[model samples]
Target: MMSETNPYMMVGERLCMDFINTVSWRESADKRREWFTSYAKWVDWCIHAEVLTGQQAKALLLEAEEKPSEAGDVLKQAIEMREVMYRIFKSISKDISPHQPDLELFNASVSHFYQTLQIIHEKDHYTLKFKQTENNLGIMLPPILQSAVDLLISNNDLERVKQCEGDPCGWLFFDTSRNRSRRWCSMSDCGNRAKARRFYQKEK
Candidate 1:
């Protein structure tokens, strides 16, 4: 069930970017509400993001409940990975190199992700997919890792990546616009707020 006050915004064009954006406001010196407060919420976001099916989400939730401590540890790991990705991508957005520690952390996740890779026989072609097993937490990570890997390896894709111009809303996104002029996380949210602020300043 979705929370009445849930703030899981998905403004990023890419899955990994959206996941990094689970943190509400990035440029804010003070912290904001973290969307993935628990393993269940993370599962919910995965379901909302279409990363997991209803049945898969239900099973993961059941497993989490059975092993609460393990679930917490996984959640902590997820958040740590998320922050590392955020820093690395933010550096990329600025055309700067990511910190060594962040790059090492990302490589560790990538190494783990590659270990689960498998080929699936689809209707016409063999598609690559992660091997789903009893280690649900580990299984959940590869798709997100793949998204990051895909963006990092593509020069054009990396060039289109941007950080939102809205103050304190330092979310990253893939600028899918033809002109690559996307400057805000969302026109309805930060964009409008910025415009309103400009209007108020002009009047003053």
Candidate 2:
């Protein structure tokens, strides 16, 4: 189950987009904050994102506790993958091709994802999952990577993809508005701030 109050918001409509937004104030020159500071926090975000079940998260956390070094390495890899993804999608938003290196990095992650694919039966249905072999935390990347690949290849409205207009907020999202006029990440946060700033400027 997910928490009622999370410091992070799921402003991104796509799973991959939400995963990329784990960092706060991503476009800021300074004062940026990382939400996935540790392996446990990363697992928590994964649970909240529904990328991992509660049981899988618990098992992973237990394994991480026993193997801190491995866990740390996985965390680093996850961060690196997230950054590469952000660059690729940010390029897509601008109608520019992703850098060859970024594509290669993403393809590597995709390759790893398929290597560990597994079929499991649960609750009267069968689903594909990454086999949890030895508590390797990098296993988390495949599903997230697949989400990005799906978004890139799908016919879903790519024109609706947008980066928030909020200064220092570089979160990418699919604008699901009928008119495609959505702007800020959230109206209660950046939207309200922008409105207040406009009012203040008008009164000056």
Candidate 3:
């Protein structure tokens, strides 16, 4: 059920999966639309994806204005990381190993971001947190990366990761169906179109 007005279609049950699905028509060269056109757009998606609060997004946007070039560089880095993640996860969904270079790139990001990891005691309970500054424009990326890492190491859960069978739609989602019969990115969109196509061909 995708809304016409809303650009955010979060069928991916996992945060990292949704992040990997930021592009529309990913496998279609002509129709593909990149959601993260700028740092501000990335921040906007981060807010929609619940990776950032309104206040944090505002702070980051302000900082980005103050350092436009740095912001652009961070955006480029984020997109590159996203492509690497997409390839790795897509490979996993196909029951294949990710390319060695892609895995190395992913490990590099994991190593870099996890350095900000720290333990915090709140209300007599200990929890791990990324303790980077509030205005860190790339702060939203670490959590998404952690989500991917968690899924990758979950072993059994890796079986649940699937790419939509909707041709060039190319969205990935965590298949939560009990029988694992799910296929398209959405029953209302890709699924319906596929169904109609079958009917049309039969009639023809």
Angstrom error at residue 82, model 1: 0.7
The segments of candidate 1 whose C-alpha lies over 4 angstroms from its true place after superposition are 1-7, 29-31
Rank order (by lDDT, best first)? 3, 1, 2
lDDT (C-alpha) at residue 33 in model 3: 95
Q: Which candidate comes out best when scored by TM-score?
A: 3
Task: Supply every candidate's count of residue pairs whose N, Cα or C atoms clash at under 3 angstroms.
Answer: 0, 0, 0
- lDDT tens string, model 2, 1-204? 123765569989888999998888999979689998999999998887888889989988988988899999999999999999999988888888889999999998888677888889999999988776564666677788888888888746777778888898998988888999999878887888899999999999
Candidates sorted by TM-score, descending order? 3, 1, 2
Which of candidates 1 and 3 is the stronger one according to lDDT? 3
- Candidate No. with top lDDT: 3
State each model's CA lDDT, in order.
0.86, 0.86, 0.91
lDDT of 2 at 192: 89
User: Cα deviation of 137 in candidate 1 (Å)?
Assistant: 2.8
What is the Å distance of residue 172 in model 3 from its true position? 0.7
Tens-place lDDT per residue, model 3, 129-160, is 99886538789889999999999999999999
> In model 3, where do residues sit more than 4 Å from their true spots?
2-7, 133-135
Model 1, 82-137: lDDT tens digits are: 89999999999999999999999999989977887889999999988888756776
Which residue pairs collide, candidate 1? none
What ranges in model 2 sit over 4 Å off?
Answer: 1-7, 118-126
